[model samples]
Target: MRGWGDIPHFIHQSAGTLRNGPLVQFLNNIDITIMNKPADYSASEMKQISKRYTTVANQINRHRTNELKNQTIIFNLSESFANPNRVPGVKLKNNPIPNIEKIKKRTTSGIMLSSGYGGGTANIEYMALTGFAMCNFAQTLSTPYTQLVPYLRHNPSIIQSFNYAIAIHPYSSKFYDRGIDYPKFGFNKFFYLGNKKAPIIHQKKIGANSYLSDETAYDNTLNQLSRHPQGQFINLITMQNHLPYNHLYHHISHYKATVPANGTIAAQVENYAMGIHYTDQAVAKFIKEIDNIDRPITLVFYGDHLPGIYRNSMKKDGLKLHETDYFIYSNPAAQRLGAKNLTKHNHYVGPNDFIAMTA
Candidate 1:
């Protein structure tokens, strides 16, 4: 099978009856082992891979980490966040994300080359946490969270460097097999909507029919931060700006989009923009809340991917559609501790570069 999406059809066609539970389970295991088998590399290819890693190791060794010794790091992955202006023939009456735009001016900010366009949120998160580029993997190795992470014996990640690290997502933990995969990545705790150990403390949804707002996501993050006095690494994924952009918000932003499509797409675009606006305001508030804390703190914020809502614009924008916003900001406390020069301005980088850049 090409990817996880093909498994259902494969099972339907090959497995005649679902009544034989043991037989089905046996076949499933065989299929998984075959699909996720590691590639056989020649001696030359192995040499090249070793050389690449050695070079990376040398580059990392050259950097000084004294500035970051006392800083708490937070990775904020925003859902379906994109620059609306990237869409062709689209015109915004006003900027939907003024706060982020302003913050980008003075910090290490740039456009990240996202691996997926409309979806595949997990892949981006995987790269950010692991510092491994998806482009190096075989094309069939799609949706690694389901196809690969479970079978692996060890999954190395940035979380391993921290004594206290947690992941928080304001949605169901079951998505992308994260419920099974997070432990392998070495997260101390994973918080989500239905997690029994650390259930989501802030579950306030936005609009009449929408996912939880970023404000509540930040509240939960702050609660987690407060518990860890020394320091912590937080991976927060916000769901307020997620899909089904069909008038979820009561009042859409005034920033109008003029896609060369029907009214339905336009309405969706506007609603998505409104969600971005909310995130912008919520992020400003979050940054302010953390600024007063005495300890050093650094936040790495970025959009996962553009919303799949733009069918016509996706084709027109091409590679531009794959570029989303990213920025790294250290608060006053971190700056006071010689953290001002930790990150430099980068115009373009891949999602895999985030962990390396921050380190």
Candidate 2:
């Protein structure tokens, strides 16, 4: 991972004018025809439908704001529960943890962020990349990675906002049809688990599952940036610290859960804390590397969803299940771009605003 970052590949981005105009028009026409009352609509009707669809679709695209330039962005989606104490404005009233006040003291910087309930990572995954809710596409709520993604080709994605985009995951491509969806979403390439496994740091088990550490995932993303330093975005989704905290890791941490220390639930909570600690270390390392580097980078780091653990850290703090955590971390270059208010408190964002928040 260390050596990978030094190697450099210079990439120049070419201008992208809409490439699937006719295809989009065709789909829009179909949509219009389906919406209208069924009649023996002639070829002339189809022509009018096509024309209308093209006009409306074009109008939609027109609303797209400009992309941020000269800055590399990384949307790093770490797994599982993001303790709300880490963010400001979180309050615990209904379901307070045993020692939440002390827990809050342990929290670092950033704003509290959340995604909608259920649908696992795909819910926020779709929203963050496409900036359109799963509900927006209807079928997407059910089969985003499989059916919906393959069907929507050349739709507007934040990927197009950057000159180059790459998706990095340290796990199998088989899950969630990412191999198909990522490309269509405009990612230039991907770094994921395959025949040749990814080189990950802290690859040890946190609870029961063996995971590719967040540190490794982030480092690989930097490695991608090293390969192509100019005008790039890296979407790094991690797999470490997933769920099912029923068992123990081969090499586990002694960090105890803040809750009463004797039950099965206590064990699970402690396991999550230990995993969170490792994630925190990895994040610190990742941030340090960016700070020392010469590249102009803007990073959006957050949890995709809450881990399906019993003591949801949110419940302890009186927050909803949808609320996980998110933050935009940028260097000096990005800060100058009217993003000075990033560290400002009370951001309170959701998955749908991911695109706008980063920009």
Candidate 3:
């Protein structure tokens, strides 16, 4: 698997990422420990590589045919994490999935079932969008955002079939260098807090980093979509619930943290709950506004990964992280046959399986 990096380079970049071109900029800054020099290939080999890429692409596109064509799809990569149930000893005043029971009736709901892999947002986003896990490449070559996303010229996302596709992140485009990578995933438009043309959200400070409120991000997304009349795929990666949760939000005192006072963990726990509360409220508000849209729409919301302050389910020795919650929401307009009522899924949903399961 160590030598297999070149295969993705050839399959994705036509020859290898060594040549002077779009991907060369990324390759130029590489350390040999991760990637050595690319194998030299003749021009004839480059032609063959292109042919192979086309053949593979055609086969994949054929196998993964799009199911929902005209329906609007919004996939929100919510930050941090929280479970549906109350953490023992903590009082949660806010419903994380606000009115989830009521909203469940309006659409199909289920757990996106994820492994306790501490891969973070970029890896999960790659899996959810491509329906392939990090293990597809070697785990050592982790984070497709930096490794694979920079090389690809095309994508196989379910949203490729949509008439319009856009990406919005209420954070820096440079955070993961997503500014350069999203286009490779077939996003027709990209908006971020760093982009002046994009709607800027008033951020709240969570520790040293400024966090954009989910409420404002949702409104900006809605505003962006208002011009497009459905058949749009919107990827919203949120940032409000990021780490350094030591600050206190008085409004959420009702959902007080039960952890020991004066510890780093206690502050994180308290601030985290408050952050989750705000996220829940944002979802409720987003739902209320989008429900009025005349076109059919499907919204999928899931936490990117568990935050840094918390530990996995294991008390002494456990590698597993507690799975985050994910729910698929179908508005009245997008309800399909037999999907009039919310459906529950019993199986665990891998991040890669999100596209197929949600569709």
Candidate 4:
């Protein structure tokens, strides 16, 4: 029968000679095992075994071919890793003193708006002007200047220009999809110095099974900072510290029992704390970048809205609910301009008031 005896000659031939004689002997034994089979085996049985073996061999061959292809592609891409031509040089020279003075001037009447998570009282527009006492830039502009409407108007031509603006709604992919077409708005010319696409600032959602990489987030933030510079205000809403958490404890196998009924509320708190730690690290890197830059930068950092983990859940975990909180970290320009004693107020503040207060 056409069985093990017909083991492909190419496979054996492709097996390279080993540097060690003993290893060669070991491979010979493997070849013998591949070749040898019981003569008494039925024709159907042999056929079934051969089919299974062939199926496995084909899968392995395809996998190996793909691996080689991927390796070659990676090697080629790596050659251009640090090539200067691949990375375009910045056209704008770093502006020094006036940039700082500009920030100071802006903050003299400027409002910085920051919002934490959740809907209702903590919405972005409401929080900016209400919670922070800043002006609503959106309200001043009509349909042509509205967030999604203008971008939808512009389309492909907007994409051609490097200038683009992206605003992400709290937790929706629809917003991002709409943002992809933002350049279509005629305002593209208004925002970009040249014909450029506007950049979108959005939030990231971290899943329970997901691994949080602060470095990746930092890289993304840096890339945004580099691209936008002074063109657009970049806002980042982070989910690193999001709650009702599950994935946070995946890394620690030992404490699986200690995690609460809903994955141990206390452990979840710790996980949330860890998430905040990673977020803080990311923010720290962002601050460093601003400090390094010669231009005056205003960075407002604060919570969108506090997580509502349920009163029962909190009691079960022996925790207490607290009022909403916000913090701002600004450049020396903002500070020198008298951005001081930004008090922590306890009230149901909305977005517009938030911006107005800060302004």
Best by lDDT: 1
- Writing each residue's lDDT as its tens digit, candidate 1 over 1-359 gives 33532233121212422433445534544444324345785788889999999998779768655534346999999997888887666667788999999999888888988988788899999999989888767665666776678778998888877887889998887778788888888788999988888999867877765688999899999898788867778999999988888868765658676776533377888888888998999999999989988888889999999888766545656788798999988889888766554344478888888887776
Task: State model 2's lDDT.
Answer: 0.60
Candidate 2, residues 195-282, lDDT tens digits: the string is 2533433344443557767777777776776778787878888887777555645333354434422232556655566666677777
lDDT of 3 by residue, 178-250 (tens): 8877878778888886677665555444334467778767877888768777588889888887765665465
Clash count, one per candidate? 0, 1, 1, 56
- On the 0 to 100 scale, the lDDT of residue 160 in model 2 is 82
In model 2, pairs of residues that clash are: 92-317
Could you report the Cα RMSD, in angstroms, for every candidate shown? 4.6, 12.9, 8.2, 26.9
Q: Count backbone overlaps in model 3.
A: 1
Ranking 3 against 4 by lDDT, winner: 3
lDDT of each: 0.79, 0.60, 0.65, 0.35
Tens-place lDDT per residue, model 4, 128-192, is: 41232323333322111122233243332212222333332222222222233233422232211
